[model samples]
Target chain A: MPLPAKAFQRWLHGIAPDTSMADVCRLSQVKRTTLAQQLVRGKVAEATVVSISRAFNVSPVTSLAYFEVYRDLAGPLVPPTRQELVSQIATVDLLRAVIARTAPEEGGGGAEESTARPAESWELSPVPHATSVKNWVDAIDDGELRHRVSAATGIAPQNYSAQLTANRLAPEVAIATSRAAGVGLAGGLVATGLITEAEAGWAAGARRAALDGLSDGELTALAGDRLQTLGKALRRQEHDQEQTEKIWENLG
Target chain B: MIEILQWTTLVACAAATLSRIPNLVRKKNRSLFYIFALMTVATLLSIKAPYLAIDGMLGNTNVANLLLRFIIFGAIYFLGMRIAKGFGDVHGLQFIRGRAGTVVLGLISLALLILFALMDSEGSSVGMMDVYAKDERNRLLVEYYGAAGRAYPAYVCLAILPAMLRAAGSTLPAMLRISALLLAVGGIAITLSLLFPVIPPALGYLTFIINYTAILCFVFGLMLIWLAKAMARRKVPEHIRKPAGT
Candidate 1:
């Protein structure tokens, strides 16, 4: 059987127990009357949807999915399948992960990388096993994890905790946490069955394309040891190619 | 009406000076502190109080003119340096701060002063206020000084203003965005005043007014920036305040 048509409403209530419908309207900067009417008619404006999502500390995609379910209920009233719900939620999670990685801190500083182990040394580290999001959350110190997630995603600490307890991973938060903990995104997401290998490959390619777009000056301006590692690697590759060419000439 | 405008300009200069003191005391930004200090001195020199006494001491050889011009040049140079620093151009800052750069700037100021003195006829004492009423030679000297004064700051503004505006347009803090906007307006105003001198006899009375308005705009714009920094400092918690050079 398909999930109930009221699944979106139920999810909203579960995640944001302290937040009222009026509070959501107020925080979203929309009129309470307008929102009420929209909810009644099973229709929400796009901008209003974004505001409501932000107000409840939920991802915009997830909020839109919830609203879509409501909008669809006004028609044939066929509930969403389990797989469909999972896909919608997983997309929201992934978006949140990307946002957490990219968002600048209060002073316009980039998100701080973990100082415990350098990113370049990850190859030498032991490979981590894929864990379910709920199990991962349970294993870690909840307070520190919440703070990191909040810093990354701009989601409230309470909402972050509630989402984790409910066995949902805001993709950005999950990806960022996994990255910091030295578990790769693909490993975590694949283990959870949240993303297929094809989707993971596409994501990796997109990231590479984005990095390739940066100008030489911008690449140089990037702070930390990442630049040093990249410079060393480039030089080593050049040196190896030169040695190989000399050997080929000697053979000829 | 002229007297009122003169007094208003003086008031603005005084306000700009007072507004800068807190930032100077905090020592938050060295370039900004120097910009305000030089501006205050420039305003005082403009009114012919200290310069009149100095000129008399020097046998009215117009040495005070050289001194005043040097201070104005210093103000413009510092303003350029501050903008360069804001744009995160470390090399630009190094160029301005280097010994070689300082020597070049000093030489340029000396050359300009000598050229102005040579251009002016013997014993001519045409105040900046009376530039329009003066003869062609004195008017040319004033025009040269105006052009030279505006050139450095204008170049700096042209190079960095777009970058600053882009930064401001992004998701930066509100105070930073406002400060960038104020600085742009001030830079544009200074450029305009230089480009359009009060040359026509009918508008001769406006020479001092226009100059002072430009000065006020530049100083007030910097003052707003100082205010923004002060606000940011207050927002930072006391416990996190680190010692200097840490």
Candidate 2:
């Protein structure tokens, strides 16, 4: 049997059995009537949810996610707009680009590859194959692909297929799918005109030389471990650059 | 000893003038260049030989005295405005931005010039060395000239002192901070000289010493500020470092 739609309410009741709804309102600093209406509708504001979570001594993100799951179970959520969907996909594409740029070569022989070929020969291919988001998603045939993508992206498995079908996959979902399927979805998105040329250019430029010797499977496997390291390094570089500029401005 | 001190001051003024030439050639910070140029001319006039030479050229009517008084006072006023503007640029203070403050200063300078001219007479000499030895009536006029002349430059210096101190305390580079400190010291020195009431027999020599020391400090401070900026531009950011073992 499927789990009850009121899982969040049930959890709330279990944790705060003796605490009245008025007590929750008082603790959260939300109005009694508003809390009651939100509880009934299975929808809570993030601030109110965080406050309630604090009152119950629960993790705020976990509590918020529970509420989101409960709200979806209670009613079908409205789909995101097309523009939002595209933006989400672009963000995923950007993440993937970062991954591809930092990923090591397939044979672990990056130095060797450079030595074997002239530096200019490693420039990105001018006419790489183009594929759309729909075409890329359709190519994957595994029954558990939705689950894998959901696990990676944190989107519900049930919604993955629908989102993929409607071209509404969030960036995280796209990144997860890219990891699972062993392909760069961002490149495909760029090719299909979903991601603009300007948006994709930086990623392409950064990764082109690094990725020259790597095959499809190697890039996908590399994405899982390199994400945090590259993200941190990029942020550190940006911070250092900012500090240098500030020092120069002060000297002036 | 006083003549040697005067010559040292003249040398310092000449050095300041030479230092500003590169800045002028680069077309950078023209206001600062003009300040140095004015200071040089003022310093030249303050020396006995140049003052007497110019006095002789003007048929000993003391017009050079009037002209030198105006130039020195005007230079100090302009220096104050420039410092105020520099402080404004660094700290975003609105009161120091425009020409209105400088115009007000100019008017005050003009008034001082007129006062000095009205005090000048057949017996009343203008330069510090000759002014003290005149008759009782002439001495009163010379005292007026002396007080006004010292007080105006002192006022300009004291007015800009707080801003220089603030700049010294701010996040400006070490050289600029040092520059500001030097300027503040110069301002304080000039102000102290003005505040002293007793006219020592060595008053002329003392004034020349104080004025030159202040100008040298200010000039050195400005040079450090420029040097700091140049060094900062030449520094490379750490992120642009080459790959390890490259």
DockQ of each model vs. true complex: 0.00, 0.02
Considering every candidate listed, which one attains the maximal lDDT?
2
lDDT of 1 by residue, B55-74 (tens): 67766666566677678777
Q: Candidate 2's residue-wise lDDT over A95-178, tens digit each?
A: 344343455543344442243324422323231122134434544525666667777767776576556434454433454565
Report how far residue A239 has shifted in candidate 2, in Å. 16
Model 2 misplaced stretches (Cα beyond 4 Å): A1-252, B89-107, B120-128, B202-205, B237-246
lDDT of each: 0.51, 0.56
iRMSD value for model 2: 10.4
lDDT value for model 2: 0.56
Q: Tell me which residue pairs clash in candidate 2.
A: none
Share of real contacts kept by model 1? 0.00
Cα lDDT tens digits for candidate 1, A83-103:
222222222222333333444
Point to the candidate with the largest DockQ: 2
Per-residue lDDT tens digits for candidate 2, residues B137-237, read 55676666666667667767766787788768755546767888988888887887774457476664666577677877777776676676677667763
In candidate 1, the residue pairs with backbone N, CA or C atoms under 3 Å apart (3 or more residues apart, or in different chains) clash, namely A93-A171, A94-A171, A96-A172, A97-A171, A97-A172
